[model samples]
Target: MEKLLQTVRITINDKLYVKDPESSDLGKRIIRESIKMIYEIGFESFTFKKLGTRIGSNESSIYRYFENKHKLLLYLASWYWGWLEYQLVFATNSIPDARLKLQSAIEIMTQPTEIDTAFTHIDEVMLNKIVINEYSKSYLTKEVDQENKEGYFVIYKRLVNRMSTMIKEVKPSYPYPSSLASCLLEGALHQYFLMDHFNSLTDCSIKNTPTAYFKHLVFNALND
Candidate 1:
């Protein structure tokens, strides 16, 4: 898997950035630092100016890569989803059983993230935290319709569709495969958030993970 990942490059939407951050050293630094900064201070308080000061570069340099903080957040979110899609494809492609393949995909989506050494410039762990905590800010906006038209969310939608297809494979007669696919993806994030901030509201935790909960939920629904 590591060898396969070494040959992979995560593609992001061109409309999401003025310049590709993976193209240059400074660009890579911007991504590496932005993930940490956003993870530390929360998106509401993060800015390119602060990121510039942290990375010892001019704030204008960041604008050359991204139009604004919102676009930067979108880029990060897009990249994370693309990276995850690669993992999902590689991990489950060889499984012969439809049920086992879908089970592996669920584990990839809901399991706690660990650092992926394949991309040295990007921290998968911190990026996962940003996705969980600040991802909604990227699309929960007035311009979402316009951005959707512009294809800013193509990668994320594709990831969901991949899972939706697997669900259909497991249960050909299932009518709500797409809806259930989206629920598992988004619900994993929500369950993690609730586990951290509102423990009493959720049954998921360190011992009882979202992965276990979703696996039970999905298999039961499909079998029923």
Candidate 2:
């Protein structure tokens, strides 16, 4: 626990420096402490008074860094995505083969490490709420332009394209489209995590676990 706290402190310091390079040492300390507090209490339950007390600074001092709670949460979400992108890129870069690349991506996505587990839980709790709220609203629904929709599709499409390229190398005669590969990966993840119930008739077991099922899907995708 001590080691984890030290690591989080270091990460907070690094992030604070990146965001505000000119900030004083004292300012960085306060920001780092505030982040630690947020990780413990969560965004919804975190209070200005509690943050101030933890950092040994008043609410006014904290406000200098962020205008409001919503703004802070937005910044955190952007930072979290940036970190995830870095990890994903690094994990995929090591495997020379396409099949291995796809396998590595699935493994990374489904299995959360100790550090990832902490951040993932917080992100799902906070960001998922915001996403659900926005997506549920009529105004927000209409506001999603084609470009933004395409951007979201691009992430999945790129993964499929990479897998397809690899599959071609392995078996040039394979008939499955990149879209189908994408669907299989996405569907497997959704069913395993987001689905309310795993239909036993399909021989799928929630008890079988995400990593096990994900590996099965990857193998089946490559085989077919």
Candidate 3:
């Protein structure tokens, strides 16, 4: 999988960035350091000037890549989703059994993220934490509809549709596959959030894993 991903390029929406970060060393550094900085300090506290100081580049240079911090966050979120979608497609596309295929997709979506060494500049694990902690900031806004129309979320929506198709494969007669799929994806994030900040609100812990809960919920819901 590592070798396969070494040749793979996770594409982000072009509109999300003023310049493509993967196109240059400086751009890559911006992405790499931005992830590190955002992971260290929450997004609300993150700034381009701080990133510029960390990377030893002028703040205006950072703006040459991303118009603003909000666009930067959108770029990051889109990149993460694109990366996960590639993993999902690669892992489950050849599975012959419907139930097992659906289960595998669920596992990929719900399991704890590990660092993907394939992308040297980005840390998948920390990006997952950002997604869990700050992804809502990317879309929870009045401009979300316009962004959606511009396909800012196509990768994420495509991922959900992939899972939804897998669900239908598992249970041809079942209704609500898309709903179930979206729930599994979003619910995993919510459960992880609860486990991290509001332990009493959720049963998922280091041992009880959101992966296990979602697998159980999905399979039972599919009546497998």
Summed backbone clashes in each candidate are 0, 0, 0
Tens digit per residue, CA lDDT, model 1, 1-224? 67877778999999888999989999999999999999999999999999999999999999999999999999999999999998899899999999999999999999999988899998999999999999999999999999999999999999999999999999999999999999999999999999889999999989999999999999999999
Pairs of residues clashing in candidate 2: none
Clashing pairs in 3: none
Q: Candidate 2 regions off by >4 Å?
A: 1-35, 115-208, 218-224
Ranking by lDDT: 1, 3, 2
lDDT of each: 0.95, 0.51, 0.92
What is the C-alpha lDDT profile of model 2 across 46-128, one tens digit per residue? 77678788767788876676666544543443344344444556678867887677677666555433354433224343342
TM-score of each: 0.98, 0.50, 0.97
Better of 2 and 3 by lDDT: 3
Of models 1 and 3, which has the larger TM-score?
Answer: 1
- In model 3, which runs have C-alpha deviations exceeding 4 angstroms? none
**TM-score-better candidate, 2 vs 3:** 3
Report the CA-based lDDT of candidate 1 relative to the real structure.
0.95
lDDT of 3 by residue, 18-59 (tens): 889899999999999999999999999999999999999999
Scored against the true structure, residue 207 in model 3 reaches a CA lDDT of 93
lDDT of 2 at 60: 80
